[model samples]
Target: MSISATEGVGPSLWGLGATTSAKTQQDKDMFLQLLVAQLRYQDPMNPTDSSQFLAQSAQFTSLEKMEEVAAQTAAMVQAQLAFGASSLVGTTVTYATGPAGDDGSPAPTATGVVDGVTFGSQGPVLSIDGTDVALAALHTVTRPGIGPDAGTAAATPADD
Candidate 1:
């Protein structure tokens, strides 16, 4: 197919740019096609190393598994933060996160722990403890935080 000038390229071998704008599956397809073509045209005297090929294949599989694990970890952290944030909406809590940094950290908003959540609104707004803040305001939501032990005195924190 002819590359259009408005599409950023006029002409090229394979009619494609070297940019990584292509999808992951497309990269996988190209890799497999190239591997097969190489195998079909390789010199018998200088054949590809079997062990090296197996190692590269293993690396690709490991990459996929790691990516999956990372995605799962992100989802878990988000769920944990959401649960922690929601649970705060019934307690009296005042906290401090940090100065809203150059990259849009929030301007230290502190509200009662047990407050009404705006329906269909975006971002974290409440604070339950020092640094145990609204998840949306955070760049990182840690594993559900363990706060002060309000044991046989007053109150236990977010251990649940």
Candidate 2:
């Protein structure tokens, strides 16, 4: 016996009637339910191939593992950004203020001591003289009382 094209492929089969932006536990549960339903309603005279079933299970497992790894990686990156930003506290930094000039002129910048660091959705931001500056906007870092020519350190994004 053959299954109809619309029988197992409809949204109703996976309980996906509700729209969602991201995958949730409900979605995973629905996927499992769909798989079970397929098995329960299949033609027993011609059972699903064992290898095909194993491949589908493997794909599900791989997808779950990949999502876990992605979440972990994001957390690690956030922690690293926080650590790097914290280190900038108490150091004088020059950071870009406005957009860069298009006529071969250098972008305007402001120099101040980093008073604190704050983490936001966009990553770490440095608090300097009552202004918030993104970590990525940092041009140089120096010790207190040190001039740019005397001892300037370049700021770059941290790598794994």
Winning candidate number (TM-score): 2
What TM-score fits each model? 0.50, 0.69
| Weakest 10 consecutive residues of candidate 2 by summed lDDT | 13-22
- What is the clash count of model 1? 1
What lDDT does model 2 reach? 0.81
Alpha-carbon shift of residue 64 in model 2 (angstroms):
0.6
How far is 129's C-alpha from truth in model 2 (Å)? 1.6
Give the distance in Å from residue 99's predicted Cα in candidate 2 to where it truly belongs.
1.2
Report per-prediction Cα RMSD to one decimal: 11.4, 10.1
> CA lDDT of 76 in candidate 2?
98
Off by over 4 Å in 2: 1-30, 102-104, 144-160
Tens digit per residue, CA lDDT, model 2, 80-156: 99998999999989999998899979989999999999889999999999999999999999977676457667799
Query: Which residue pairs show backbone clashes in model 2?
Result: none
Model 1: weakest 10-residue lDDT segment is: 5-14
